[model samples]
Target: MKLIDLNPQGGIGANSIYLQIGDVNILIDSGLNPKQAGRLAMPDFSLIKDISLDLIIITHCHLDHIGSLPVIMRQHPNAKVVMTHSSKMILDRMLHNSANVMLRQKEENNIPDYPLFTHEEVDRCVPRFTGMEFLQPQKFKGKTDEVEIMMHHAGHVAGACAVELHHKDRHIFVTGDVLFENQRTLRGAQFPSGHFDTVIMETTRGTTERQVGKERVNEVSRLIASINDTINRGGSFLLPVFALGRMQEILSIIHDARKFGRLVKCPIYAAGMGMALADYFDEISRKYQHVQFNRNIIKELNIQPTARKLDAGKDLKQNALYIISSGMLVERTPSYTLASGLIGSDKNTIGFVGYCDPDTPGGQLLQAKQGEDFTFATANVTTKLQARVERFELSGHADREELAEFAIQTQARSVVLTHGDQAARDWFTKELESKMPGSKIIDPVPLKTYEL
Candidate 1:
């Protein structure tokens, strides 16, 4: 088997790995960089433009993982796109919303080739999609060898999964974005751990561990208390959330907190693609009752949808929790607009519940001190920082310890780390060294390939 690094620099942006075993070639994921613009944002599709892929396996529907998919599909129209039934239901919403965001960027910033691929292109690719149920092995009809594929529950999002390929006497696993601990809407992944030749996995959260000395439940309780404190103080609380898993998890956590009287009851609101995803979660949960997460958490919580763009100078009136998308408060998102209006209020809280790139507006605000004046170029607004800005361990990725534990479980002779920054990979390299000293750890340098 030859493992090819298709990512441009392999530094956690635009992740794509070309796996060629026997006669067939499989592209693990097709992602677009969230930080770059135009063709530069793509995963150098030029790398595999000449190769014919038998299958394109997507791990989830997140933009960084699935955004540039249509760009490749337009080239290999016959390739079968495989994902979970849950991912299939949300892919359309994600792509369409992405198209809208790109169009807006084109008009506002004059970003040439901004849309990348149109909504019409995305619509055309759906018929060829094959959404499979979890753990059901499907044989791939390749030319040279017999390969059976299975997607285990990834537990990151509603339908996210870890890809397992059983070929001949070998087992190869590629963990998409993974979360081992159970969250509100889904249970953690139960991978079929055994001996293996190669395991390509994510190291997205290795740089930092989960909240120190607190289990996930306790960490959440603290977040709820913070939310309650702000609401009770008559200040609106803004939760800048990603529209997918984070939105659902936060909604459920807030709901349960209020239901059990652990948090003060207050109005809750959610906006953008998250509301659409909640509908899918409800559908999946109702159909698959055995699944650990409940999809109807939004309905149960009575979380209202906030106005897409709050009028300038008109902030939220009452004590409430407003959940908005673009977790990092990207310009044009509801969170960005709302943050502009609430940044000066001392009683208000702008809680960041997930990872933020240090260069993004959200990251900048998180690092800012009280009473500091900062400008958000995205929203074209400047404000003084007085509100509380806090980050929770409410991450979608497993922490460093959890990742180490998973690496040891695989027992693979070679463990290849993908999908993390320099600090995260360095931490994992040392952690895995201490934990699994018997195995070989391969860190794929940007634009370089490692053979196993």
Candidate 2:
């Protein structure tokens, strides 16, 4: 078997890996770097763009993992696309939404590669996708060899999965953005106690060893308390969420809070593709009994869809909770527009609920003080950030301790870490080295092949 890391300069952006078991060449993911644009966002496809892949397995529909899929499917038209049924439903919404976002970016930012692939391409790619249920074995029988592949829930999003590839004596496991703890809308990854020859795991949060004495339950309690306080103060609260997992998780939490009388009722609003995904989540919960999902929590939460021009209606109408998208508040998104409108007010709360890249507008807002003047770079909209700014760690990825425990449980002979910064990767490298001394911890070079 052979393994190659397509993403060398990694940080949870363009994650792609080439795994060849016998004569079958399968690509784990073809993702676009969220930080980059046009061709730069894509994984180094120059590695095997021309070669026809036996299969292309997508773990989920997040942009970092599935954004560049159309770009590759355009090249390798014959490769069978496989993902979970829930992912298929979510992907359809996300990719179409992405195309529209790119079109908007092209017109506004003068970006040449704004819509990297057209909606037409995404439309064409859907028919080719083979949506499968978790734990089902998918076999690829070559003339001389046979490899069995199974997709298991990764617990990162609605339909994220980890791929288990086995050929003869060698078994390889690819942990695709895995999470171990249960979230509001999804459960943790469900891979059982097992051993493999090689394990390719993500190191997204490996570097940020969570602050001691801070627990997830405490974080949740604090966030709920913060929300309740902001609303009780008659301040409009804004939660900027990613449309996929974070939005669903946040909504579920808020819905439960309201149900239990922990949160007093105000107007609840949800906008962007997240509203669409809630329906899909409801559908998945009904169709797949195994999926740990809520049944139309968005509907039950009385969350009205906000207008596209959210700024016009965001008049701080007495203790309303606004849940909007483009979690990072990237330029033209509704969250940014609403935030720009509310930044000048002292009675409002702009709460960020997920990881914000410091390069994004949302991340920059994290550094701004109460009296500091802030400007939305995308729109040149300026305001004094008098509004209360609170950030909570509702990240979907597992933390350092969880990841280390995953490595310990998998018991793979060799482990390769991807999807994190240098410090994060270094931390995991050292920890794994000390803990799993019997196994090899490989620090892979981008685009370099490591044979097993």
Worst 10 residues of 1 by lDDT: 288-297
Off by over 4 Å in 2: 211-213, 292-296, 312-318
Please give, for residues 1-452, the per-residue lDDT of candidate 2 as tens digits: 77788874666688888887898888888888777777888898888866678889999888888888898888888888889888887786788887887788789778887789898999999899889878989788655778898888888788899888889888888889887878877878888567888888888787566785556677787788888787888888899999888887888888888888888778898788887787788788778754555745666787787865555324556578999998988777889888888878888888887778777889899989889889986566778788999888678888888888878777788999887877788999999999998999987888888887
Error of model 2, residue 274, in angstroms: 0.3
Error of 1 at 277 (Å): 1.4
Overall lDDT per candidate, in order of appearance = 0.82, 0.82
Over 68-173, each residue of candidate 1 has an lDDT whose tens digit, in order, gives: 8998889888788998888888887898888998999899889989899898988998887889988899988668776789999887787889998988888888
C-alpha root-mean-square deviation, candidate 2: 2.3
Candidate 1: stretches off by over 4 Å: 289-300, 311-314
